[model samples]
Target: MRSFSRLNSMQTKLTLTFLLILLPLVSVSIFANYYSQSIMNEQISDRTKGALLTTLEYIDQLTQNMDQQTLLIASNPNIVDIWKGIENPLSPDHLYGIHTVQQQLTALTNVNGAVKDAFIIHGESGNGVSTLKGGIKWPDVKKDYWFQQTIKGSGGLVVYVPTRESRNPSLYMSEDMIYYMRLLDVLSSTREPNVMVLAVDKRSFQKIIQNLQTSINMNITLLYNDGFVLETNPNSENLHKEEPFSITVKKGEWSMRLEQPREEVFKLSHILQQFTYLITAISIMLAIWIAWLVYSSISKPLQQLSGAFKQFSSGNLAFEVVHQRKDEFGFVMNGFNRMAAAQRKMIEDDYEKELRLAKAEFSLLQSQINPHFLYNTLDSIYSVASSNRIPEISEMVINLARFFRVSLGKGRDSFTLAETVQHLMYYMRVQQIRKDHFTEEIELDEATKELQILKLLLQPIVENSIIHGLEQSPNEGYLCIRSRIVEDRLYVEVEDTGVGIPEDRLQEIIMEMDKITSKSYMSSPDKPTSLYYGLKNVKSRVKLYYGGDADLLIDSQEGKGTKVTLILPMGKEGHT
Candidate 1:
């Protein structure tokens, strides 16, 4: 009995050790298998969904391409010329016109891949009068119930139909058949009159089949709009299953069946599961072994370092780290100590210097702008008062009020584009009032009227042109503000027909703006500040709002004129 008890004790110890070693491996393998299966299922589902949607998208794109081709052929200028020439089909010239129609259709078909062939159908309406009726057919084009239904349903409807019988034989194999068709009415340029039926080839259907096969590992079968199975890529074994998986296409007028094997998708998931199991097993074993060592090497040191960092962040940079070993943590602590010391010394040396520089720059900028605005405002008022122009004085006051109102838009960064334009107009009015030498015209597109623009953007550019370009010219100058939107961009051009910039100076200005360091001339406090302060302010603000895309494009010819353009961010009008 004692000997049996000893053997049992030995077996229990062996069992405990074995479990300790093998438990992680078994857990990892099971987890990996389950995860792999899940991944495979997800991939299968996604591929099936994407395949269905892509098939519909392919059909839609093909339909659009065909419609565009038909419209192009119908609206061809040559068609009208041919119609005139074909007054009498018996004439040689009239026969040449008939040939021209075929030539035009052929040329269009070649350029538009979706178009199979284009022909002028020689058919007449209900009227007894005979007329030229023409229609084109795509390769493997089909005649299906959809075409007949559309013909009988709508008097003059342009419809997309199944292409089962409409396949163009020239493009597809003789044995392969089409399953769908798209029919459209060829219309005159006025579009009110129908000329003929324009049918596109079933090549789009072929593309849909090919793409669906590439995207999904399934036996895909497309059904016509009238619920007829048009095309199927399948194996013989699965062709006549009594009960098949049917997937309804919610996005399009079609049906699908993914009866293909899903083993590959599941196989990928299995591979991932195996990898994850291996990682998890390794992690669990390492975690147990490292838990104890981590307390001394990583966890304790990390706790000490964290406390030191917190102290340092709270302005106690003099705090010391107590780690002794020469490892990563020791090196980090040493670096932190050095950084803290350097930061302390640098702060002392640079704090006053930075503050002084900032204050001086601020004062200089303020002094420059303060007197400039004062001069413009005072000059406008003085002129109005001197001329006894009460209405002009009132206008000047209103403009001044509006300018300040925009300058402080509740301290917000942006204002409505209309407000920007309004303020810019007031500034221009003030400049015109003060100088009375430059004539300006402002035009804005209706679409871009409500877009938001940075405040004081155009005013400075306009001011710069008026000051540097117009002021230098002896004769009257012209300034125009024109704006338009191309695609998604808003382009505002401020052009002046004054003394244009010299080539050398223009190149220098470009370099200066590019580097953002044209402050040498701006350093002088006694010189005129309009060109410097206004330009610098506008440039800085533009950079703040839109980093690099926002810019100034200057085009000029000395003695002709200078145009300062602001390219800025574009947004929809009244969009929050």
Candidate 2:
């Protein structure tokens, strides 16, 4: 009894399992059935259009053939013969009299074996016949509607007609579609008009429909320009005998439609609907699984990272995150630590750089004070020497006195043009006593002489020529000092016809000298540091007193000459 009970339980569980599987399978089958039906219906609709487009393309080709036929007939001289033969017909003087012409036009149509009949009709009189070898009773032009349309269709040689009665006596009892292509006889002296019609038997159009049916099991209808039904496939219930698919094809117009049974379409749709339900269920399960996986992988890391960031935000600059896994978060934590370390080092380096710059500036200012003391001591010695009355000593002492007096006039920084030139004269006299190689000329505008300038400015510039410039030159050189006031600035130019400084070195020297002594007075503090020491010292003092607007310009060339120009403010107060 216990065994029987266990077996019953197993059977019941198996039944429930099968029920679960079958329920889902049944649902999926229904959905798939409906979906497939919808898809097939849409595909069938599109295929019908594509097939119609193809049929239209072939019809267009046939129309092209008809157009060529009309043009050939119009242009051929044989057409004139056919017209002449028909005009005076004998009893047997049937269309055969024009057989040769028809044969040529048939050859011209180029429609590959599908030429059912070819004929021409006179206008509105019903007098027309086929030109085939055996004179067939040509289709009646007056009875056929295509003939009427050809007569009325807007006067172009290229026109086409639809299915109608055959003109050939061989096929007179059967129905056929034909195109009446108009022709103009060029050979006739009177310019006689002509009409040529190419007839396609109904059998040809039937075959086209049969081929389409064999390709796909669908019903189709071919529409005409006038909304007339050209052809209908079997099983096409919606396509009425007279009513077509509202779309029309003109002379060369063509269209097609497909009709599917409502019951079959609905059955297919039911199956497709079952398939959609299955896919939707699977997609929902997948979405839930993906959500769980994302939560496991991303949620924990984000929470920990948020905590670390909070700590860092509250002034914990050295905070480091502990992440064992090597991923994007790990890389981010590493970069944050490296950036913090680099930022601290940069701050420390900036402070050290500032301290060094301050010490260097302080040392430079200390060096500038010595030159002022030397100038004052020289002035005192000059006073004592002049009082002692030693003639040559007094003369030298007097030059020294004047040089120092001008040099000491300002606060070791700047002086006026008057003071600079006074210093220049004393230095020039000293140059004559020492080397005695050059004559000097001084020209100053009255207005510029009183301008404030750097003290001892021109003395060094003049001294540079006497020492390195003319002192070494074998030939005697001339020194000319000229001053003028222009544009509210004093301009003092010292030009010498001596061995000149090279162009490349001239700008370098001038730039080096322009640095304020308090700023860069170092390396060799005994004299102003640089190649052009005197010029640099004066330029430095000028900039110091005048706040950098003042400048010393040097223009020179190899072996030609040197011109030193001083541009300074016109007043003693400040830059104007």
Candidate 3:
């Protein structure tokens, strides 16, 4: 009985050891398998991708060669002169020219094996010639959809893939065919719109790529920029099942895709998984001998690390890891202590920052209250000055009071267009008291009358026009403020028929304004200022509210005039 008990103890120890070894071995095997599978998949994908790219290049080159060949037939001085010769198809000169054009078409078809057929259709003569094996298939080119679209699509190249039965015999072998049409830049005066069409059999072009894809069992499909799939080799029905990888070349408006079957792609991985089971079985036996060693190396350290994290998650940051055995877990425990301390310090620092920030916010709020007081003070001054019975002083005081009233918007970001115009009139009236030469025209659009725009957008711009442009002009100084809605945009243009800005100074002023605008700052004493400061101030405000989508354009000619146009994106109420 004693001997039997000792044997049972030995078995239990062996099982424990085996579990320790098996756990890590299985994890390592999974990682190894995943890595190996990725490498093999990449190899398969690369080989297939290379084949598709090569095939795409060949097709592109073939089409380009076909285009050049068709151009030769369409623009041949003889062909152009033929169509211009006579309306009667039986005329000897016209018949001879038709024969010459047909011979050129036949030579083009022979230029490349992929070029199944070539065609030339003329509008004036009402005839088309095709190198279809039998004869020209159809006489009236206008009835053909390809010819009509080619004329409608301007003079650039056009591509067509037919769905219905094709008239050309070369296209009957497979439905996979493409036609390239280009309008000839014919020099003849009497010749109608001339178009050249080149038919390519995709199957014939794909033969050059068959050997390239042999290394990897992947099928390729070609696509145009507009998502039109060009039927190429092995365009099997299973394409819809798998998501394909694609490649596109810069010069061509074409994209190529490669697809592989799920079973084929995972064949090697399945083999590796079978081998993994064998490795796992062998590991269990070997593990029984060194179970105690693994427990000391991995399990104990892991237990300590797990306990520390568990405590940390439970709101107990104090995790005392006493195991000093130098290993990866020991490093982890030390890192945790440092991280915990840093997090606590960061929390304390954040609390302190919030306290200081609150004080600054309070001061900012206090500063805003000052604007409200100024409005009240202006109202008080207006009453006192108007009571004195001096019209000049009372008028100036009233305008000043109105200007301040419009400037203060009770914390609203935007004001109505009418309010903006009213503010401009108040400011302008004040200026007009001194500069009598300044004449103004308000050509505000009816549509913009009720729209909401950023407050003070037009006031600064108008002020700058009057002070700088009109005041200095040798001619009769005139200022025009016009607002209109063009499509989705709201354009507010400030025009000054005064001495315009010189070309060099105009560019400098624009650059300076851009610097301020890009910084996206409101006009403040702390920011770098501009000489054309009012314009800069207005631009900065415009950008701060609208970002880069809004535009402020300045155009000026020194002797003629100056125009500053503000374009803003419109919202339901006004500029968004």
Q: What is the C-alpha lDDT profile of model 2 across 209-323, one tens digit per residue? A: 5566632334555655544345555555544443332322223565555454454434646554656766766755665565455544655555566677687668565667677
Tell me, what's the RMSD of every candidate? 23.3, 21.1, 20.9
Ranking by TM-score: 3, 1, 2
1 or 3, greater by lDDT: 3
TM-score of 2: 0.34
Cα misplacement distance, residue 366 of candidate 2 (Å): 99
Best by lDDT: 3
Q: Go through the candidates in order and give each one's C-alpha lDDT.
A: 0.58, 0.61, 0.68
Cα lDDT over the full model 1 = 0.58
lDDT of 3: 0.68
User: Using Cα atoms with residue i matched to residue i, what is each candidate's TM-score against the true structure?
Assistant: 0.37, 0.34, 0.41
Q: What TM value does model 3 have? A: 0.41
Q: Model 1, 185-288: lDDT tens per residue?
A: 33332221223334454555666666666433346665645444445454435434444433556444445555554444355565666677677677667656
